[model samples]
Target: MATRGTQILNPRTGQRSVFLQTAQDTGGALFQMETFHPAHNAAEPEHTHPFQESRCQVLTGTLRFRVGGVERTVKPGEAIVIPPGVAHHFWNDGEVEAHAIQEFRPALNIEDFFVAYFALARDGKLSDGGIPKSVLQLAVLLKAYDRVLRPTNPPRFLQRVLMETLGPVGRLAGYRPDYI
Candidate 1:
């Protein structure tokens, strides 16, 4: 992987700025993803991945994060790795936005999953931390991105619910999946 890897081709594009670019993971994993500020609103919920190990590099902004049972902030230029089966969650909390890349093993098209999740969140049906104007507008932006990117399919009302939930956990639940 020359680092630039493939263009981020995932579902999260509907929200802030998320990318799941395929790359050469140092761990010799199946794919690498570059995403920005992945988070869950009230509707979005916490989740678990049964088999995949995850790694990330924080590019810009701050992310409210959790991995394996611990919570923390991953700052710019910093990187972290999450072992398989370890629960993890995160969200952005900066002025502009946050950028990060993740590595998933085997053949986890994490990109596709995020697209599904955000699409649901935008619809206002996915569970999240209550829909806010920012999130609602974010959903609209995501729909526009979908028109151009076409990541995944999630209903509109689900998006509405994801927005209504309490925190980033709701949005993330749909993204993480069984990797084993």
Candidate 2:
């Protein structure tokens, strides 16, 4: 079971997330949390979830989001919903920290994903931006998780092929599907 205050750090974006609810606590219905993202940092590259929908509500500071090719800035009390399979990315472009609540529907293994990702970062296995320095490591980790990166450079198809090819290598290197 996950507690209300379980926190995870994302070194790539310099954000700290506190879990407000977990899949176990909600019987797999939802996963919810508040993220404290540092200024001028992007939380993640554009990505998509094949099996989950997301809702984000800004609580403090300002957040910039690019959803389906449209970019916008959201402030306190603002919210946005991202349907499954939609390409989206967010960041805190403001001077102050950005606090926002994010919820995922039909929670899968996101909690575990966060745990493993943060652990890798803490172990110095990842770059300063929180990305694994090794391509194999990144492929293995991403393949084991739900979210898929949609890289704009090098074309999406090529990236997908690389991920598919490297996934098995990553597993062979002893990466598991989930950390929790």
Candidate 3:
């Protein structure tokens, strides 16, 4: 379980996530976090969660969210809910920093994903945009959290096939699932 106030920086999108409520604190019901996104940061790639829903409330600056083909700019105090299996992504579109609170239902291992990903960034194993430098590394990381992140582009079938084929190769190359 993540401790309260635990913070992680995602190098790829220039967002800092500070955990507020963790799965353990809520008995596995939910996870809540406060995120600070730098101005004009890149958007998270459109993705779907197979078993979790998410809610986001903008606290400051401007945020743009695209959910299920609908795009909206959320200002301070505005909020949005993303249903499970719906394709969604977000970006900081304001001239200043954007602060938002995000909550995930049925917590899952989303927190762990952040920890591992950020650890990779700290170790210089990721690109400037936060993507793993190696294809095998990306495969291993994504395969470990397949249930939580399903990219919407390039078709799900192709993504699955590629991941499935690469997962073993990544493992054989000594990629472990956890970074910390």
Candidate 4:
């Protein structure tokens, strides 16, 4: 479980996150963090939280977001709300680092996902695109965190099928839900 001040750095993506309110801290109602995104960083993979809505308020620099296929630039002090199940991606396009406060409602294990994902990224277990290098491990992680995040590509039904078929095998191979 993450706590207030818990910090994670994803070198691959040049993003740093500091937890301010964790799931445990709020009895699972909310998760909030401060993010320092590197300038010129690539946009994140388009993904959606199946059951959680998210809000982001920029603190410094600028962020470019593509929410539901509409792209927009967000300046300091500007905020954006992404409804549950809406595909979205963001990147820092300014010359300086971008800082933002991010919040998620009905947290639903998102902190756990960040802990594991960042650990994997730090240890070089993930690819340049932030995916696990091992297919089995990817399947296990995706299956376990399906409620918190789902990739927009490949369709939901196909992902469900792949996870169901490979998740068990991954577990049998000693891969756990938390990569760490």
Choose the strongest candidate by lDDT.
Answer: 4
Clashing pairs in 3: 12-129
RMSD (CA, Å), candidate 3 to true, equals: 1.9
**lDDT at residue 102 of model 3 (Cα atoms):** 93
List the candidates ranked by TM-score, beginning with the highest: 4, 3, 2, 1
lDDT of 3 by residue, 1-180 (tens): 467789988776778999999888888789899999999998866788888999999999989989998999999999998989999988988899999999989888887877887788778897664567888877787788877777776487776766799878989989876786
Ranking by lDDT: 4, 3, 2, 1
User: Whole-model Cα lDDT per candidate?
Assistant: 0.48, 0.78, 0.84, 0.90
Candidate 1 lands at a TM-score of 0.53
Q: What would the TM-scores of all predictions be?
A: 0.53, 0.84, 0.89, 0.96
- What's the lDDT of the predicted structure labeled candidate 4? 0.90
The superposed Cα distance between candidate 1 and the true structure at residue 92, in angstroms, equals 1.7
lDDT of 3: 0.84
The worst-scoring run of ten residues by lDDT in candidate 3 lies at 126-135
Q: Write the per-residue lDDT of candidate 2 for residues 16-105, one digit (tens) a residue.
A: 999999988998889999889898986665677667888999999999999999999999999999998888888999999999999988
- After best superposition, candidate 1 residue 51: deviation in angstroms? 0.9
lDDT of 1 by residue, 130-169 (tens): 2223444444434323222221224546544543452244
Query: Which runs in model 1 stand beyond 4 Å of their true positions?
Result: 1-14, 17-29, 38-44, 129-180
Query: Which candidate model has the greater lDDT, 1 or 3?
Result: 3
Q: Whose TM-score is greatest here?
A: 4
